[model samples]
Target chain A: MDAIFKDFGKAYAEFDGYNLAKTLAPVAPEAQPDRLYNFHRSTNFSSVQKDFKSKILHNNALPFKLTSEESNGWVEVYCAYWKAVGEILNAEAATKTHNKVSWGKVYEAWKEMTVVLIRGYTNSGFQAWTVPCLYVAGKYMRVFAIKADEDAANNPSSAINFQDDFNPEAEKNEKLEDAARQLNRMFQICLSDRAPLEESRKWGIYNIINLLFKTYFKLGSVSLSKNILKALQAYRGDMPPLDNFPLSHQVTFKYYVGVICFLEENYVEAEKHLTEAWHLCHKDAVRNKELILTYLIPCHLLTTHTLPTLALLSPYPRLQDLFLPLSRCIKKGDLSGFDAALIAGEDEFVKRRIYLTLERGRDIALRNLLRKVFIAGGVEEAKEPNAPPVRRTRIPVAEFGAAISIGSKETMDNDEVECLLANMIYKLVLFGAFGLRRRIYRLHMKVCLAQPYPPPIRRDFSGGTTSRT
Target chain B: MSAAPQSGSAPTTNATSSDKNADPAKDTKPAAALEEDDEFEDFPVENWTQDDTEVPGDNTHLWEESWDDDDTSEDFSAQLKEELKKVEASKKR
Candidate 1:
């Protein structure tokens, strides 16, 4: 115990954050015999407090003596750390025995520990290093909150009473929501710090933001994630460049920002962020890469009217299954096949919140079919010698109707086919040319004659013109 | 077409297309069955350099510019011929 205090005192005096965090962290059950194991076993709070005071405060070997105020902060933090650890161990033992009631105790202990740690954040020379300790406390607070919520939901008596005072606006996971509030306080602390960069709490901002991102996403409150981004944007100049942060922080920030843009249907911005995340992401992180690609592939299809090649998807079998058939049908201009593929992957697409975006790919398929029609209309011969031969731009409406009927299941009347053409023109899948009333669909001469006719499919579902070529 | 499938409510043309190829088993399965496996994972190491990532270069091989293949025009033209013939026959009937 004396040695443990000696090490803690040494780390605290030197502001050695990593080592300080080590002292606070609970020992794993599998760790071999060590002096730290004795600290872990010291479940009596009063005795532990006695040892901390006698060994750490009085010991002359620490090289520097802590001020009374500093020693008070340390005493509080040290005692709270062990108290939370003890409750966590109790909770684990209870979990082994399927004792659900003890979970709330773990959450309470961690909540208190987090408060103590937050107070400790204001202590001079401890602000930067103690961020990890706050993270651990907040993380477990949310975890145990979830466990407690699940236990309450599963318990019959609790469920029976849950309906009595249930308000639709009330949080279903009260404890978890409280954890988010506490995390927000930490976020505020980090953001409001005006200290020099070397010792500023600002360094902790992304870590807290990442934790908030996880919490809000788990709570299905994605809009709150936007608030975090907006706050970061407000402080953009004060904050360090994203690249200066750890790779983990950069990759995680980009990935979440990308997904948020994705959910908002901002495909272009989403593509930019998700692509950066993909490039910066660790090569060994196959799952993270796959996740980035999950949103990225759809963004690519929507923004650039492109498809992922088999080689691009070979590494991710699940994505291949989700996207391959859809890509194939779009390329072939097979309307029925596209519809079938969409239906088959509907659940997965909706789960990913990308069903609407992928639905727009049908326009691309129709555009390809229309492109084939223009290509089949080979160039008409030039009337005079030395004149350029003009590519055919005008085709009988019946030709398009024929193509549509062949691609779909049933034959359509001319009026129905014309309506479909009108929709395609509006979508910019087929560049609108005048003469629909005459039953001859005149394609835009320049657009249709371009090598890849009808231009790339540019769809703007936001009711804006698809002016992007 | 007389047998128009269900018309969708959205402005985008949800033409009543045939579902002969759609697998009922696939459609009927609950959405939750397709578990989201690509969740964000914590990094094993807190920091690394660009060297730890994939060597960035041309990304063209992954994305194809145009959906068309070499044989697409020929196949489409031949199919259009057959379909135009069918349309002509239907008009005559």
Candidate 2:
């Protein structure tokens, strides 16, 4: 393979795009592949031969049976595909769309061209020059995906989010999945090749992974994102140290992992990754920074019972809008107030998908309420003279009811108050003891009151008022 | 959005007053002032769905592929380790 590539490299050395600064100039978007198809294939043979060089090294793992003629033909196809890539990237970046190339059309062309490349390369390995080209193309997938999202958001016809209706992105997924698979194929080839990836080539892998992550996220298939992370981890020693990676990869990886941990209620791990993401995130990328803090703040509240201060939240008004009321309620130990704050921000939190995590912040409210109850209870007298005067740790259900009822408009029943306490205990927001003197649980309510709450007590359904209902 | 910190507990209600005012219906009007909290209890926590966070950017979402914006960023791996250690220490006692 090397010998063939060496020969190919010699014949086309001067024509390689790397050396031809002139070719970097944007081609008129109108003079795209559609126009190229009308030209005689033989007319550009000399120029094609000049341009199709072996700057891209081949992978030895999947060698192809190619005569010189066949190799030259593949080179022409690869060059044509890359040419299309450059044209689209350039046009996409232009401030004004002079000859606005339909991204859908460009994406379609990318798919057709990449299918041929994948089949050929799976049988015979890839060239290193193709790596960056493939990476940039993968990056362009975001543009296409965003365009699809925008179209959905804008078109009132597509705006309705119907549960029973078929997904509008079904066709979009077919295109996105094809693009993602092609990118993954190139990435896998880069990974499994006999030689280690060069420092310059490693960015291609990260770019490919990040692109795939975004595509999966948009598809709402986070399991695929999990698979990508697992695959990347398997190549840990083979790849560069994570610190040496581009910042985009670092932030994206941590953000995904942090969010996944948060969804799973692993607040400890979530806080770790999210804090790293927050610190390393670009200061000026205000939106991205806010996104990081969105999850990070919730993780902090759940794990440490600390709320974002006014100073910390001042700069990001959106965050302040989202968190200010909730923080106030948590600080004040107001269950109803916390619930109110959550209600006020439900739409925003649901839109951001942090509602579940923030919902868990009620545990913080419960903790505060229990703490207040303990303080308000003061010192309970010992039943026996020998018994030590204990701090009012033994809280009656009635006291909890009174405390909870203060901020709540309705009078809560004893059973409802007990259920709330039970939930608090179950969620580990409050810890205490259990002293049940009787097996007859119907009479145990009074006995349980003097004792710290314990789990596994059969709930009384006779009250017909348990809040758990 | 209102920056008022009036959510905190008012200490004017001493133990004696609270005992005297144990009638929940009599005190209900004060709680009614916060009608937002009333609706808050209806939020369905157990049924809340976990979905993906959106990719951040404003309208006209053109961006470059290279992540060079964070050139002077701190070492996140070290910071993560430091944070994890702190959490572990707190958990121990």
Candidate 3:
């Protein structure tokens, strides 16, 4: 215990934030036999305090000495850390004994620790290093809050009084909500830092923002993520280039931003961000890579009429099952097959908030079918003498109607087929030129003669002719 | 091309033809198993460059042109011919 304080004191005096964080973190269960945190075994706050004071503050034999001012801040932070660890110990004991109340106590203790740690951000020499400490405090605070909330829901009689005055309107998950608010305070502290780049609290920005993103996403309050992005954008000029940040920060930031754009139907921007995240992502991060590809693959399908190859999907079996059927259906221009695949993956896609985007692939299938129809038309001699013959691009509407009926589950009347054709023409004009000339379908060869039909460009399907740029 | 509205009259034939032609089992699997850990976490690595990526080169091998040029193969061509013959026969009727 004395050596633990000595090392902590040395790190503190040297302004080594990273080591301070390591020292401050609660000892993991597997490391219980280690003497450094053997004090944790005592499970009493005052006794630990007695040890901290006698071992470091009152002992003149210690190599590092703290001034009175530094001693005051150190004592305060130490007390907060000890209280949090004590509550955690209590929570663990409670878990063994199935005591619900101790979870709430743990949450409250960590909440207090977060508040105390925020003060270090304003301390001149300690500002830069406070981030790691705050991260630990904030993360566990949320974790325990979630546990507390679950306990409250499961055993309402033991619900902790989260506020001084109870309001009848207190919503469920109030504990988690309060934890989010505390995290927001930490976010603000980092954002408002006016210090120079070297020791600025601004360095903590992405880490805090990432935490907020996780929270917002879990709460299903996706719109709130946009506010964080707005705030970051407002501070962009003052902040360092994102590329200069840590890779974890960069990848996490881009993933959230990409998913946000994806939800907003901004496939182009979403693809750009998600692709960067995927490319720069760590090789061993299989789960994260799968998550990135979860959104990235749909964005790829929409923005560029492309599907992930079997090799890409092979590594991720979940992605393979979710995407392979859809890609095969689209490639074959099999409308009924596409519908079946979409319906089969509907639940997972909807859970990922991508059902609507994947639903748009039906248009591509229809376009491919139309492309095949044009090819089947073969070539026709030009009416004018000496003019090179052109691929037969003009055909009756019934030909398309037949292909449509052949691809779909039910045979459609001419009217329904025409409506489907008109809709496809409006959405996919760039794929091939189609004109309904007196009930005859004219597939214009001029726009793409060599490649008679290209992939359709992404367009807005929400009741407007305005194409997506 | 058949001008007759055969599709409207023989709905069963069209339905069965599409069902036989569009086999959905070639590459697909059962619905994907639910994802276990959906939440994103910070990567273990704080910083890395392209050297650290799983795949070394440009990701050309990962994505391919979606259009299948061989779509005009025997089966699809045969199906198209049958459908066109149906249209022409109906028009003559």
Best by DockQ: 1
DockQ of the two-chain complex in candidate 3? 0.22
Q: Of models 1 and 2, which has the larger lDDT?
A: 1
Weakest ten-residue segment in model 1 chain A by summed lDDT: A28-37
Off by over 4 Å in 2: A1-101, A112-130, A145-169, A197-203, A378-394, A434-469, B1-93
lDDT score, candidate 3, position A231: 89
DockQ of model 2 vs. true complex: 0.01
Instruction: Summarize candidate 2's per-residue lDDT along A11-119 as a digit string, tens digits.
Output: 3453332222112111211223222222223224456445444434232332334455446546654565655554444334231223433445555555555555555
Give lDDT per model, in order.
Answer: 0.71, 0.54, 0.70
Better of 2 and 3 by lDDT: 3
Off by over 4 Å in 1: A1-16, A26-38, A98-101, A123-125, A156-159, A162-165, A168-171, A376-392, A406-410, A432-434, A437-469, B1-39, B73-81, B91-93
In the range B4-74, model 1's lDDT, one tens digit per residue, is: 12112333333312232222322332112212223477686778888889777747788987776435445
Candidate 3 off by > 4 Å: A2-7, A27-37, A54-67, A94-102, A122-125, A156-170, A381-390, A429-469, B1-37, B74-81
Candidate 1, residues A32-147: lDDT per residue as tens digits? 22333346575375587776666656667777776776677777777777776666555543443445556567677778877877876666345576576666666566666776
In TM-score terms, candidate 1 sits at 0.80
Q: Give all TM-scores, in the order shown.
A: 0.80, 0.59, 0.80
